[model samples]
Target: MSTYHIPVMLKECLEGLDIKPNGIYVDVTFGGGGHTRAILEKLDGGMLYAFDQDADAKANAEEFQQHRSFTFVESNFRFLKRQLRFHGVKQVDGILADLGVSSHQLDEGSRGFSTRFDGELDMRMDQGAAVTAKHVVNEYEQKDLIHILSAYGEVKNAKTLAAAIIRARGMKTIHRNEQLREIALTCAPRGREMKYLAQLFQAIRIEVNDEMGALHEFLEQTPEVLAPGGRLVVMSYHSLEDRPVKNFINAGNIRGKQEKDFYGNIIRPLESITRKPIIAGEEELERNNRARSAKLRVAERVQSK
Candidate 1:
């Protein structure tokens, strides 16, 4: 587990939860069980429920099987409310979500999540997913590719890159990361090849995994699954994810638009605890490069009048 993936902002995330020794908590992205282990340590007889879609993560959860207080659900956090219901859990004290791909997935060449790895064009976080990165690269229309690269990746030259992909695939299918990278290099600006490729891959992976959609679903259910005053701690790695999370915490919805009651009181479901997202400290940055992009936000469920 030590090498699976280093937990980003470990101390900060644990602090954000403001853990209760005997309260029920959930770790939605139980990547390598690093944070799960820490949460378990804090609990005496409390419960720590973990969720992970990847089979590899499920196997890692087995390491904590000896602790009866720990429960692992082999499913996506998008199904948060329902899965918890299966375990007779109606509400929780806190929920911690570490968004984006885990370091283990990136380091494993076969997963095709890293720019350094020249592997198959398969970026599904759950291997069972049907739509692989190869499908998006080879089958998506030019306009669709442009939209994905522009919106999901924030790639500046999305138009040119999308056109290049379409043209290159006409000669042969883009079935490998190296093959796609070669085509992307043709459009990448000087000295920025890696950055462009990273964005490109991010865009494709998000689309294949329906990350934005899943995040929206998960956020919508938090109000129902968390008890009043329960904490919602999320760590996101990109602006695309951070924006929605920030919006939800601020406006009580992803659109960032406020709703009011007949009495003119704002009908917010959660209260923001961190005005600004937390970042990794210098000491942690030195130990793990993955922490460099992490941004953590904490909020607590609002009590109903």
Candidate 2:
């Protein structure tokens, strides 16, 4: 099959997983199956389960239907534990999650994920999802928009931009991506217009899909889903996504707060395999600019206490 997305840091992610040929594995974000196909190549009697909610991803998985060792789950990774249990899988040997928008999603303008494209304001990772960018931009209260911009995007002038959105939508409902872009352009800083626009779109996308909320739920289930000595390899494109993954591996929670037992031992389900996130090599950067922001973190499930 043709390439859909060039998997970022492919070698590093494979090394991080420390794949066992006979082990059970999962690729939670099987966008174009770049990583999934690689993992499948290394498997013998092992089974690999891939998860994605996007309709396009489901279609991409069709080729693997005949592969005895592969299974494609048509659901979000947030339901990780429940889905695994339903499939009669108590635990898996390794889990790989690449939390980034797929190349196809952005390239398809009707998906409304790119700033350069003009399409309807619909940015749901899962098309079936109720909320969309249109709902967020037009229906959210001014204060809520300000909070989403500041917290999710880290946009500096969140209040001003939120006010602008409120005013623009007040005149007419913002139905298209271009309409919202123009409103944000008016509030964007002179030299950083593109960056500001990207941040603004990122904030709305995150809210529309409940990305952070799904991430927290998924992370909480990793420990229970992983077998002892199993690896959890994750690649995140932004700090917002990386922080929780780092904290959960180190502290057993998304908050990064360590809890102590009666004997003063810090309790956590996974042990950090990498103290710092691994970045893509210079060669990979020259080949694919999207790999520039990618950060890979690895952790292992600790033996039962």
Candidate 3:
């Protein structure tokens, strides 16, 4: 279970937090504990709570071996509100969520998270969870498949791909990565194999985890969980994740627009720290390919009751 998770945009996230030595903070996506370690170093009297839905992330959780103020909770972050309340805490000074699967999950052959890997069709981030890519491919209807592929995967040929899947799935249940790849290839244009297949896989993974839906819910609770002047630093790998976060912080809604009162007074709980999303640099892109798509957005909670 020795997995490699290279935290993307580490420095930017740390700066975004504006870490207070004695302020309570949370790392919602504790993949490999890379960022968690950085967060710990910046804290003294403050405590850091890290959450990861995947049990496998615990394998790298050992980095904080001697940490007294770090707590790792294994669960989906969509329920972040309830979970933190259960801990007898209400507000936190800072919260960071890296809303993407880790490199370890993608590199591991058995995880089926990568299109490069030929394994089972299962892509459940939390192995203990019931839903997987298999269910999405095997049970999803043509209309549903089209929606997932187009919206989540951003597949250009979503309708064609969905049709191909439906046709192939009828003959037999697709249980392995190789079979799924073949289906994708057969449906895709001859030269578009790589691009088409990757998009299809991305679509299925998002659907299996309800990544977009969960991200929306998580952002909805952020304003409530954050204390006044608390920082909300979020790192998103895809537009779907970043868009909502960017909108919510700037306008206090998911639409990324400001709200105005009858008297034209602007009211919002959070203020967008970055007018545009922060992208990884050339150095980081070269070091970690994952950084190519990473976008870091930060916001500070405004004074509100």
Candidate 4:
């Protein structure tokens, strides 16, 4: 599993969870099950439930099927609450979500996640998803492309890039990663072609997976799914993901603005445990490059009065 993905900030994530020996836990993005395995080791009578929409992840989880303490759900974390209910789990002691593309997905060229590859533009994290990167690139209107690029990728010249894509697709359908990369290069800044291309791909991938929407749904359910005092540990790769997470933790909602009650008391579902998001230390960064972009935030469910 280490080769598949050397779970970023493993030590920090564990410490953030502050695992209890008998606490029920959920690893929302199971990936290679590295964090899930670590959680299992700390539990004596506790149970660990893992969720992943990717079929490959479900296959990876087969390794733990014999362990009565572990259960894997073949679904996205967006359905966190409903899935838990199906399993007879009303609440959990802790939940951990690593909101980054898995190493396996990026390294596998056919998955169409990396600019370094020239595979089909099919970046659906869940292959079963209706939309794919190809659809976003070829079928989306120019204005929609601009929005996705600007909002999801933070591209500086999204409008120009969108025009380029529109023109390119008109000549011939953009079906491959290299094909889209070529179109993006025309609008890329002179010296930062690689960065520009990466941003373009990131935008399409986010749209294909509806990453932000799913994140919001999963977060909305966290306050209800977590037992009082239970931890919510999330590691996000980009600002698109981290910003909402930060807001939800600090303000108890994605809007990042406090909602007050009739008595002027703030209504919040969780309290931020870390004053700021935790980044990988020099040691972890040296061991795993993926750790460089990781931002981990910890929160505890606020008890109702």
Best by lDDT: 2
For all predicted structures, in order, the TM-scores are: 0.98, 0.98, 0.95, 0.98
User: Per lDDT, what order, best first?
Assistant: 2, 1, 4, 3
Worst 10 residues of 4 by lDDT: 1-10
Off by over 4 Å in 3: 1-3, 63-65, 189-191
Candidate 1 similarity to native, TM-score: 0.98
Clashing pairs in 4: none
Q: Candidate 3 at residue 145, lDDT?
A: 94
RMSD of each: 1.0, 1.0, 1.7, 1.0
Please list all clashing residue pairs in model 3, or write none if there are none: 247-256
* Candidate 1 wrongly placed segments (more than 4 Å): none
lDDT of 2: 0.94
Cα misplacement distance, residue 56 of candidate 1 (Å): 1.3
Q: Model 1: which residue pairs collide?
A: none
Candidate 2 off by > 4 Å: 1-3
lDDT (Cα, tens digit) per residue for candidate 2, span 15-111: 9999999999999999999999999999999999999999999999999999999999998999999988989999999999999998777777798
